[model samples]
Target: MKRIILVAGATGNLGNKICKELIKRDADVKAIVRATTSLEKKETLTKMGVEVIEINLSNIDEVEAACLGVDCVISALAGLGDVVLDLQKSVLDGALKAGVPRFIPSDFCTNYNALVPGENRNFDLRRQFKTYLDGTAIKASSIFNGAFADILKYNTPILNLKDKSIGYWGEKADWKLDFTTMEDTAAFTADVALDQNAPRDLQIASFQISPNMIWTDVNTATGQEFRMQQLSNLEDFAQFIKKQRADHPAGENELYAKWQQAQYMYSMFSTQHARLDNLRYKDLDWTTSLEYIKSFVK
Candidate 1:
């Protein structure tokens, strides 16, 4: 029997990649899109041979109908509390109603299990949904890929490409932060969605590299010989971001506020994958940090 996989948030960045990967793997793919999604986007999905189902997500009957016969539902839905907590619950309820056996939540970031509570709001939302998910009978798995490796393109404290410098916090210059390219993550997810016996959690990194290591990779890839800088210790950086978050109440409503981004930066240096499951799926050709940097540097 062909694996039937249903995906929510099919039009977004990571979500779209996952759909294509699923189709490439020959799964019977279904995408749950908002009724208001543009015609062009729907056509794009249809072109890929995905069954595009437009429904009112709040309507359990409609959602249940879309979920019927689905072997697994993969939610790449992104948002604050409204979508993550409330809308995901609605989706889960419909999956339960339809008797779907597996669910993959949109937890494509650091090993949040290793982070302290009340430190990262975005992670906290995922953590809250996880609590609700654990109480259910459906098999759930969260894939933690650390920060997306794409962040390297953006000039962050860690890898300031424009500045020709790499940096770190406290003594974490050697910490191996997990990073997986979206393409890599999507390919792995496609494999997991078809897996009937996947575990509660699976972690992988296309390549794990420390700040010290990033400097070397950058040099090898670009020959730029980027310099290094120490930002600050984790404790002081955490306190600074806490103050920034409290001082700016308006940012709470936005998805990636400045403090939230800083919180994410803190998380990268703070926690890493205790172990990796990269070899679970044998077909993936992982991208290395050197190759990733080489892509844009030249």
Candidate 2:
């Protein structure tokens, strides 16, 4: 029998990709979308063989009805406090009420648990949800995919493509930063949703390459030998971001503020995937850092 899977946030980037991956594996997929969601998004999901339903999201009964017979509930909803906390709780409540045994929350990012409370604002929200989730009767799995490999193309501080320079905050030039491509993450997530015995925490990375190791790939890809430069000590950089956050008070309302982005950079150098669960799904084709870097240039 095909695995019946229900997904929230089906119209979103990662959610949509996860749904597609489920469909690729021949799982019977259903999606709960907001009534205000675009017709194009609903039609797109419909075309992909998903049973798309419009739910209030706040209505536990409606969400419970939606969760009735699905084997697993995967939430790929991406947002700040309101969506991640309140809306996700509603989904969790409905799933438990409906006796859905397995759940995969939208904890698809760095190992936020490894960082301190105030280090990353967004991660704090997930940490808050986790406390509640742990107390529940339902089984849940949190997939920590580290940084998305797609960020490499954005020319972040470490991978500055324009200046041909790799900068580090401190002695982190050789730190292996974990990165998983969306495709890989989605693929692994789809498999985990189908696995009834998936562990509570699963960490996976397509590649873990440091700035020192990445520069060679950048040089080969662009035919330019990039220089490694230390921007400042990590402690000093942390203080700089603290001041930036204090200066821009309005950024507290914004999801990806400048300081928040800096916090993410600080996190990349500070903590890494202590172990990767990439091999859990033996068939997954992990994307290498060199291939990803070359893709950026191409």
For every candidate in turn, the CA RMSD to the true structure comes to 0.9, 0.9
TM for candidate 2 is 0.98
Off by over 4 Å in 1: none
* Residue runs of model 2 more than 4 Å from their true location after superposition: none
lDDT of each: 0.91, 0.91
Residues 1-298 of candidate 1: C-alpha lDDT, one tens digit per residue: 8899999989998999999999998999999888899999999999999999999887778889999999999999999999999988889889999999999998888878888999999999999999999999999989988889899889988888778888899988898888999999999999999988899999999999999888888788767788888888888999999999999999999999999999999998888888999999998999998889788775
Taking all chains together, each candidate's TM-score versus the true structure is 0.98, 0.98
Model 2 agreement with the true structure over 1-298: per-residue lDDT tens digits: 9999999988988999999999999999999999999999999999999999999998999999999998999999888989899999999999899989999999999989889999888899999999989989989999999999888878888877788789887888888999999989999999999999899999999999988889888877777888899999999999998999999999998999999999899988889988989888788899998898888774
Quickly count the clashes in candidate 1: 0
Clashing pairs in 1: none
